[model samples]
Target: MPFYTYMLHCSDGSYYTGHTDDLEQRISQHHAGNLGGYTKSRRPVRLVWSQEFGERYEALRAERQIKGWSRAKKEALIDRRWDELSRLARSQSQFTLRQAQGERVSIVADAFEAMQSAAQTAHPREACGLLLGEGDCITAALKTRNVHPSPETHFEIDPQALIDAYRSEREGGLRVMGYFHSHPTGSPSPSETDKAMAAHDGKIWAIVADDDVMFWADDKDGFHALSYDVGSG
Candidate 1:
């Protein structure tokens, strides 16, 4: 079974982090008022972020690490705001570098369309997917949805699906470059929780909209936005 470290944005604007093997079922329990305690009183929680790991240990470790963060920090992680996470992680690091420096970055036309389609399909909740790129140019996109309700809103990308995509991309000498997701009701900017969960380096985080797309790079300043074009080379 796959393990996940997830963050929940509670009704009171508080954040909760925990680990679960079955994200969908766990979130369902929370929503049904069956999963009591902290989240129970907070009611009407929403899943703001999640990450998949290969092992239980990794998931648990990430959970523990996130559970210790402040609410703002948790939001940064959920938003994949690397610079903010790094600032919290490295309070005194002087120099910072942006990830997409001079790389040939451009959103794929197909991926943008897929994102728009997914967003419309998952209205009132978030949508997510992976973006395939070659060097810095996005080549393709795959989208998915969270069938579960709030507090347990979880999305999954099948390993086989990923493998198949990887193989197809490799055949064309492309690579699984990064990931894209929508905030639904939230701004395209990265949240504090998002920063906490962002990868350390060399990763792309794209935020999609009904009309626009934004990219961020992990830097000393916490997820600084970079210039990007959607459906353009």
Candidate 2:
């Protein structure tokens, strides 16, 4: 039997994270208020997310790690927004780089060209990819398979590809600066779903629309338009 890490949306609009060996029974306990702890007072809780792990320790570790996340990051995990989660894992000091950089993003010229070409090639369907580099300078835009069922309306990078990227980063590879996606028929701006899925970490989001590419910063306040330069960066 697998252990599980779960998150609950409490009636008070707060979130609770925990681990358990019996997901069904544990959720039942929370619903019945039998635990007599956080969920007791915050009754009428709803299970918003859960992930199964092969080991108890893994589940427990995930629970502890998630407990420390901000509400936005937690929601990003629940939504499986891999790009947002990637940057959200950065330390607080790293996030400060966005402020220190004067609200600007820098990208290599070829990377910009590649992203535009990808958008044009994937026309009528959404093209998605990972932005890789250090700090605010994007050196590459590595295209990933769009695994969303409705590719024309939405985009979801293959989770396995994202997992591989993170693993590579852990082994001293390029940093996961942010992500890129095309809006086949819309403006090069975040859509409603983008806003809802934002991690609120200080990461960049490049949107391609109508052959135009624009960059935005994901800040806690909301998405902010960012000026960018294309060159050696």
Best by lDDT: 2
**Which candidate comes out best when scored by TM-score?**
2
Q: Please, what are the lDDT tens digits per residue for candidate 1 over residues 120-173?
A: 455556677777877777767777444334512334445566677778777885
Clashing pairs in 2: none
lDDT of 2 by residue, 66-123 (tens): 6545556888888999888877767433644554367777787558756765776677
Summed backbone clashes in each candidate are 23, 0
TM-score for predicted model 2 compared with the true structure: 0.56
Candidate 1 is scored at a TM of 0.47
Candidate 2, superposed: residue stretches over 4 Å from native = 1-101
